[model samples]
Target: MSGSDDQSGLLVLGPLLRYVDETSASVWVETREPATVTVQRGTDSASARTFAVHGHHYALVELDGLQPGTTQAYTVAVDGATVWPEVASPFPAPVIATLERGRPLRLAFGSCRTSVSHDKRGNETHGVDAMRAWALEMAGQVQPADPDDPDLDPSRVPDLVLFLGDQVYADETTDAMRAFIESRRDIDQAPWTELKDYEEYAHLYALAWSDPANRWLLSTVPSAMIFDDHDIRDDWNTSQDWRRKMEATSWWHGRIVAGLASYWVYQHLGNMSPSQRAQDELYAQVLAHEGDDELDFGDLIDAFADRVDQQPQTYRWSYTRDFDTQARLVVVDSRAARQLDPDDRAMLDRDEAAWLDEQLRGDVDHLLVGTSLPFLLARGLHHLEAFSEALAQGAWGDRGARMGEKLRQTVDLEHWGAFQNSFQQLAHQTIDVAAGRRGRAPSTVTFLSGDVHHSYVSEAWPVEPGRHVESTILQAVCSPIRNPLSRNMRFATAVLSYGIAGPVGRLASRSTRVPDPPLDWHYAEGPWFDNNLACLQLDGPSLRMWWVTGEVHDGDHERPRLAKVASYALDADGNPPPREGTVSKLRRRLRPR
Candidate 1:
């Protein structure tokens, strides 16, 4: 129990804890061969047969009938022989943690991690991996907490880790990923360095998750994921012109199909609760079968992915969950469900937008909106994006439109701000939620997002509101848990997205038909470029957040230390959380009262 053997070849990857509720938890695994995968805790056990996708075997075992507000160490097995814990493991035992009714919730989240080496050179190039540092910190803990138990000590580990996007960079593959790609196909071809099919994706994931530290962390902590543009391609569905250009590529067809299909098998399957999975036709198909032979989903999944890509209306990627009466998490699908037509450009298609509207209501202690892309960028960046979108839609002239189109793709000027209509709709809906127009107002309405490589927190207030808003409206962004923007880009962001750019961008957008944003915001904390992970803790009627980064200590890059970068809290009356240390300190220091 106190040692770890670097085991290899027992299983392909994972014993990843994916879903947990009051009475059950879901465990996912990729097997070395077709076999029955089981999850066991003491005497109680749950098992499921493997399903093949393009020669790869996988299973999701749901362990039910668990006691609420309890934590128990769990083991994974292939055909009933323990494959996890590896006999001599240095890491502590992983646990099955179920939520108790009306208990507080704590979650860790961030996005944009690129898989690379963890040694000195890699750390120098990409900075320390926040996730790995977190895993090491967690590994030192003696026991996992019963997350909802008021009597138990707060564990450093979170109940769940919400991975916002770009979990694996299919577009920006690492050298090892590229070598894997070369082993599979011709390097001279189109989509050369990028992933081409599901087989390649399988290898990519193995590369990403096989790290002992991160993998151990994932096995212990449940995670929910959504994809971003880099998960498929950079600036995916950015505009009509961009779509056209990608469509013209010879490799785009296989790429998108494989991307979506692999995403389904690897990430989306465990996102649902038992009832939701039962409602899924494909899941039902896999489970309904009881033949002696294991089910092969290779062709079925590819076709399903293709169909979903062609007609996004056939399926809904967005999902929601409630933590008793404490919190509601609505994770929206920002990358897949977009309306890219010039006349009706929307970040989310009509159906997806409508579904999100329904989930945006208030009635809980805290309301959390999880979108892969930031809903509110820095004011300057938002205005600039709005102006670009208007110009691309022929606000200025044909020449200006062409220039705007080029600029949009060139600088990645696509976000909620670019889709002004969609942004306004959500802004108004958020105001309604805060004002109790839709439901009883919560203590806080927070948008949790990550897409840009830098992290920041912004405070928003409705412009010229007629009624008192009952909840704090805020945007908290934590980005690039590993990958970071270059130094030059960080400096540019500080200038262009923070200070002078706001007035200039607003002036530019005034020349177009883009309506004024209903809510206005200013930075409360950061534009910090550190590779960090963030957490949100819902404590009774109040909410708190903090960001942490991995710092190399004593030249030990492999076992970097965790360092806190920031902290903030939400209040009852919707006031901006005292600017970290309150304006009083800064006022006293700078203004000389």
Candidate 2:
């Protein structure tokens, strides 16, 4: 049903335990009407009511007066009706999970999934949605886990899910969305029959979230997401030139405003921890209400979107969370915090850069920086960006700029290297963290990324000690949870990048008397391309990263299975000495068949 068609219905987001503190935590959701949101201790009939809040569709039911390091079952009640089922699938309903000090965390993260029906396959081009498949298995519906293996419990789930980017595609709306558009507007228009207003965005969200498996997953699993280019449009914020072109378009303004505004309502608000949301202007207003009255945030949302598009520095697209002393996760918004000026271009503007620098703290066992696009591009791709940037600035003039523009338009080469200044700044930050400038050196400073339609891991060699250099760091990229790479483009990228780009970049850097990123800073742990899902586990001071994909044999019966595509582990010794060729070969052996 369209979002407008179903306004009065149950929408439960959490017993998701966000911002869990010594005694209280916040639970948030979007509901039809203001109702009494309740949290209980055990099952649906549990007598211990943790907390209750009234009126607001979004509730932060702070479970105050609770003991720490304890496990308790919780449920939500609206107007004396238990919203959560007594028995939840894959496990038990209102299962008791704990909050304790110094626990190991398992985080599942991926991006670029389209909202399609779980029932049918319209085209076999890219294959089924990897996320829905995974969620299905987790729900004990499609690919149920082994029954005899008692060690596996459905009640025990991952702590949080990190969605890097492209959670929804406004440009590539689903068939259902198209149908709605076809009924309402003309497809012969310039921008065609894509999303146009809040109504459309709401429908898009419903399609994205309504999948039973993913919906259940979201209800229990707290998730954090940041937008990418596709979340708005492909190659968004590539350069000021691109922005100027878009601004001249007839529909660009409404599209951007609607995109950002809907993002605030559908995604960004849920991303913030309770404490963080309190600082948000919209949420603050939401917090003040106490009846079943509709809290209209139209003005606030519109204003916030305008301010962000006009002045990105006013708010950061980055956030950091500490997983006790074990790990620190920093999710950065690469698209929003960009300086697109050709003269002084940087991936991140001053404010965002400074904020990111501050967040790259030390002393954590593992530091995970989640940038939607990998900060470290492939050697060949990196060279192309450098080459084009140089070419654009030199006597080549319009030709050079046009070449760069064409590459960005047809090929996605606009990454960290495109904005040289910001790349250098981040490089400095990585080097400093590795050199133990922040605090005790982390076991690994891992940059987790998704967006390139393939998965790979790269390691940056530490500048030698006592040689005025920096310590080693790593970057892991997992992409396109459903989108698969075409063979021709893959081969082209390989040829243009690794084969031709490297040597050219080196020669150009030396000839022009300009510094180039060190050659020692490059090595790939994977080149495995497929529609995939990646998981990372932290065991003590050690780190394990792997990618999985579904195997097909012409029928729908073969459900998605976890096949190891690539795996990387940081040595527990707290030092990543240049293994050089060692990790690359190992990764190749571990790659998916």
Best by lDDT: 1
Candidate 2 Cα lDDT to native: 0.67
The pairs that clash in candidate 2 are 55-291, 88-93, 380-497, 462-471, 462-472, 463-470
What does each candidate score in C-alpha RMSD? 4.5, 5.0
Residue 22 of model 1 has an lDDT of 86
User: After aligning candidate 2 to the native by TM-score, how far in Å is the CA of 280 from where it should be?
Assistant: 1.5
Residue 265, candidate 2: C-alpha displacement in angstroms: 2.0
Q: TM-score per candidate, in order?
A: 0.94, 0.86
Q: Please, what is the whole-model Cα lDDT of each candidate in the order they appear?
A: 0.84, 0.67
- CA error at residue 502 for candidate 2, angstroms: 2.6
lDDT tens digits by residue: candidate 2, 1-593: 32223223555444444444434555555555655566676432322211122222455555555566665656666556566543334533433344456766777788888876544363265556666656655666553334343222334366677888988888987788899878878978957867776667666777777665566666666577889998888889988878999889998877888788877766776667667877887677766755545556666677778788979988776888787887899999899878877787888888888788889988888889999988887776776676666665552567766776776666676888766667767877787787788887777788889988777778786444463323347788878887666776666545544545778766754453335663245654666666667777776667766665655433653354333455666656654445455333433433333
Q: Please give the lDDT score for candidate 1.
A: 0.84
- Which one is best on TM-score? 1
